[model samples]
Target chain A: MSTLNEVLTKNLHGLYYGNRILLPFKADILKAVIEKSIITDFSDFSEQAEYEIKDNRTEIYFYEYADLSEFITTYETIKLIVVEEGRDIFDIKNHIKLILHLNDGHEIKIEEAGENFLFIE
Target chain B: MRKILPVVLLAFLLFGMTNQVNASDFVNPAALSAEIVNSDAEHSLPPVFMVIPFVTLLLLIAVMPLFAHHFWEKHYPKFSIALGTITVLYYLLVMNDTHSLLHTLAEYLSFIALLASLFVASGGILIKVDKKATPMLNVIFLLFGAVIANIIGTTGASMLLIRPFIKINQDRIKPYHIIFFIFLISNIGGALTPIGDPPLFLGFLRGVDFFWVFEHVWYMWLPTIIVVAAVFYFIDSRNNDGQEKSKEYTGQIEFKGYKNVVYLLIILISVFIDPNVISWVPNLYPLPFGIREIIMFSVVYLSYKTADKEILSSNEFDFEPIKEVAYLFIGIFATMIPALQLIAYEANLLGDKLNPGIFYWATGLLSGFLDNAPTYLNFLSAAMGKYGWDVNNAVDVHNFEIEHAVYLQAISVAAVFFGAMTYIGNGPNFMVKSISERAGIKMPSFFAYLIKYSIPILIPIFILVWLAFYYGRV
Candidate 1:
């Protein structure tokens, strides 16, 4: 039962419509998180995307390509994943990692910042 | 000659009957003295500009095109030049210093933005729809307008729907059909709910429940629908029969901008967020700004970004309609301030002595000529003072077991249903008429329109509705 405020504060560059937030993740990873969350009928992805992030001190903007609704649902799912992983869900970095749910999809891992997770794939 | 005789006869009879009633109704000297004192008090006050707006707006609209063409031809060769001069004159002089500038601006902007969005969206639909699908689409479009009117409001639904109605019938040789359309879809169809018409919307704001109107649907809805549908069917059949089968556009229907539909939905949903409804969303925390105000800005942004430029260019979306509506309504909304004040005072005077049937007919009849929304509120406030039927008392009155609620309901129904009786009755009716004329349908003159179109078709249906449903019950 992660609050929207809590998750929103952690994800500085996330997107939302009403209460739903779009996550920052690879298209496939975002799709997996959305399916698990059961928040949307995930469909085609966008070629250009924008992320809206808000925090206590600063707000940042980012650009990426992903399905909008799916991205939002995945962001919500990531908040749940962080709590379920028994991680300190308050940390923004930990929340971002939790969004990248791996195959055998129930489990998720946090790829630390500045790590070469993109290359490893 | 034939038509003139009946109208004259009816006018004489009405005046005669009213004069007799006034003479006899003044028996008690004490009561008469009190009445005279009250009348003197009302008369002593600085006369408020009430009828000026309605009359002026109608005159300006009728004469505007003539002035536009004249000015354009004589001095400013460009249409835009003439339009600009008129717009400036309108804003600076006519609409200046009379009302709250900020309130007027906000209303004008919203009105313009909504009308522009509808024009663009409908233009997109027009480009995509095949010529063959148009007749069916026209009816469907109007029906959609009727539904939306009940949801957003007559003004909202009209601004959003009129463009598409205009676009669908743009190529038609006959245009009076669209005037009838404005009557039914834009005005009459919105009678079912508080959100449907301005009068009902005002009622909801003053204390009526959002759902309280449904109670009268049994009496009002069935009659309104049958009449409107019958009129639409007749007009549509006449137009179809006269139409020549022309191979207009052979292209396949190609909807380039279906995504804009989402923006339309956003606007439709915003109706529920209007300040009145937002106050009812239980357990909702207060937002920094009004929910409806926020939603309005957001939808405008969405529409501005998503609308297809090509479609807009093709339809030649001009500022004229918005400019015209803004200019006319400025006078209307301004002068109406006093008219409404006087109406409120009068309704208070009538108090509980006013019968519901009388309220129904009077309110409806007045609404047909004057703006229905204010007329509705005027009668509603009168009913409330007499019946003790404000929001707090809404539930309490059930225990009284009287027909006071029924009378109130009748007032509500009549205000909404009969508002469509004349062209000037609703804001969009005249706009639709102008748009149709612009598209080349020799629309009838104002009186001609009522006599030939609305009266013959609508009045009979209205009578049938009254006889079958509203007559005996109350």
Candidate 2:
């Protein structure tokens, strides 16, 4: 019954799920991802994460997993795990479900209401 | 109204002088003094031929229903119309009856109107031109304009090509580098020929050989081409880098009908034949009296008929841009008459003491601010007077060491280069800027444009020109 905010605070990682998440890190990362695959050296990212900041919020896919153990691991704090059925993970047709799992095994699901928001499901 | 008053007063002063003078003044000393005063007054009046009809046309165009549509209203609607009306009023009411203000006005207006028609027609053509090919289309249009400047004259090319440039770059959210390209390529690229610019054309008519420009091609052509190409490359790179690749299309682009291309060709050919028409060869071809006119009007008619209606419908072709050009240029051409006359008549009085370098700098500076063509002619004439006339042999170099031809070449080069210094210096500069603005590129303001772009970019080009052409081995 942990809230998404509490899980995000405890894990020190937040999950974003939509079409393409506007990385809070830097724009060159996105550009590098699109142009060249290797995203080495994020030194250009400002303390405020200036490079990735866009005029509007970036969109990323949303997804949910039925069995959280498949995505969670002992050493890693799962920042985001999105699940889709009967389609590729990036496919728009399948409903997207997103979960943020903390090291403590607390989980929060991101859902769509009017806008994208985090919630415990 | 404020601008029109001086012109009216000048007109009245000229009219009073012409009427008050006696015919016997030539025989009698006292009467001759009066005649001299009258002639002075006449000269003081604005060139009525260029003035009156321009003003009248401006007024009519301003009040016309077709001019009040949404397009004009959005961009310079009221100012353009008001300017046009004022121009027409100045010419008709203020100028004296004897001056050729009306005739000159008609000639220039005809020129402007022909350009207006071309702008509208070509804009329509752009809308019909395949959207995917727009970038290639723009490059083609720019190259075409550059080439045509050598053939028809820069003003002619500018008038003919600007609409298409305006239309191709009409999509909002695009960059405005095209305006700078037009100034460099369309305006200055044609520096090598008398036919390429009005000043050079004046030179040809004034006894400079039609091919004299070719003699200095090594000096003029190379610099112009190199500078323009450099500017184009820089701009094209910036535009490409800034824009995102777009894949969305409604799949609605179709040629509809392309027979209008022929009409465009005819208009181009007319530029070559325009001098001939004036020289009367076309008249002697044993066709009807207004046969040339008939042919010209018919071409326009057919083009209008054959243009893809759907494309025109999509672009919402309107007369706003043309109307704006027509109105502004009327004031420009009219007010300019007195200024040009003064320069032409009084250049010798200012002393032929000015060297080619001084003339180059002076003419370039003025041409940068004023219209370059008239500025070129004024200095060209002054150069002629300074070099002296062999009354009998017709070629004289008074005190100058350089050949008269070299001086002429220098002046021509200056005129072309300096005309690129300002938005209003050449016709297409403003049109290209406006089009880019419409496309949503925030172009710099008048002084800001010069300070930010021209000074930094064009100065180096000018220096290269100086070393390579004017001060170089020729």
Candidate 3:
């Protein structure tokens, strides 16, 4: 192989985003992100969601945002999604779902907020 | 209480501006129309003093964002509108060429429409780079941009690539990555076709064949891209922290809103349709620009209506960038009219000394400061004057393209390439900077960027092109 990067760029470039940003990932990182990253703030535009989170110990910052509303909601179907899709909803896809809550009621969530319920900051 | 002053002033400025917007509402027609460049049958050159507003206003775009950051950000639209109003009044009253003004506005509207459509459509599609921020990967990204910039237009390609470029390289992003991206993708990549950059598209409007740049400038583009990518690789390799953070994103790369591509294609197709001449307006420029504007706007609407709002949300797309461009370019396009007329007059004065090398340096240097679209027109018009061609006639411009191919080539390259030299040189440079800053990349300042990165890297590459293409041809 000339290089995986060479192949990746060529194949990835023809897709929707076409900038090689549509990165494929494992199911585990999103779990790590949800737990280890201390979400300092969260907001979204209309159905889009964004969270300002920092690594719990290192204090490093990373952001998570997606307008995944089309695929999610409290419409009596979230439980079905959880069962069928599992935590892939929060996987590092182009978008991630808003949150997850434990049986003990501890919460991990992104708040939906902003101007005219529209735009990104 | 804090917002009242600006709100009051905005209202005052808006009212005052609306009252006096006719073509000759401000300037004394008898005094200022002496050296008019015949835009049509009876149009004259804009007065020399008009450059003051143009230069000062453009300078303020770069300067105010630094020292007066908060105040400038809040008041920039007003500032832009106020400066644009000066030119509108001058054009209406002093020159009394309503026909030329309308023609310019028509062209201006279409120009803004294509840019806005690309911005919105491209922004609607999010690209998430899962690759690690390696030197090799960054080079690949830059090369892809360099190729695609010609297809989508620099602003379009820049909007698509900049975020993902920033994201993938977020950890190791030094000043060089962003700077090189600007140099290669935002400016130089657009050198080969009218579809690539605004200046070249204007050349197309005046009848230069679409394929002319590909035939003439492809030789220039290839080596320049390679050399720059090599330089970027060297710099990036030296800075690698020896930590292997290269990891794949954890899910299959996915997409939403791919249909927006159809809208983008529609916008591109509209550029080919010739608009009808508004005969009653009298003294029209050749391009039926109004038709293109209508079609591009319609595409923008169709894309918005059809794409799920989720696509826009996932991409974090917004309209603020376009609004800012619209307001500021009105100032830029309007005020630069006189400056161009003056440059044309001076170019005419040079007579036969208008060599290809002269055209190259002159057009390139001005593009770094003034927006390149008009700067290209200025030098091209001047070169036409040297060949005794008519500046207002499309047929003459086309003729100049044939008779003085080398000079036309130089003008095209200079206007498109050197825009990477400064922040305001191209529309997307500032937008990219703005977006990157939001993503937490602290970009270099205007003077600092030139002194350090752009001048060192780009000037040498430009010199090579000059030596190869234009040294003896003029």
Q: Score chain B of each candidate by TM-score.
A: 0.69, 0.67, 0.85
TM-score of each: 0.57, 0.56, 0.72
Full-model lDDT for every candidate = 0.48, 0.47, 0.62
lDDT digits (tens) for residues B377-419 of candidate 1: 5676566657565422334333221345676676777777776
Q: What stretches of model 1 exceed 4 Å from their correct place?
A: A1-121, B1-128, B131-141, B152-172, B239-256, B274-276, B279-291, B389-403, B472-474
Number of the top candidate by DockQ? 3
* List of clashing residue pairs for candidate 1: A12-A53, A21-A72, A22-A71, A22-A72, A23-A71, B199-B373
Residue B293, model 2: Cα distance from true site in angstroms: 7.7
Alpha carbon lDDT of residue B38, candidate 1? 31
Model 2 interface DockQ: 0.01
lDDT digits (tens) for residues B446-474 of candidate 3 = 87788898899888988988898888775
Each candidate's fnat, in order? 0.00, 0.00, 0.00
lDDT of 2 at B103: 28
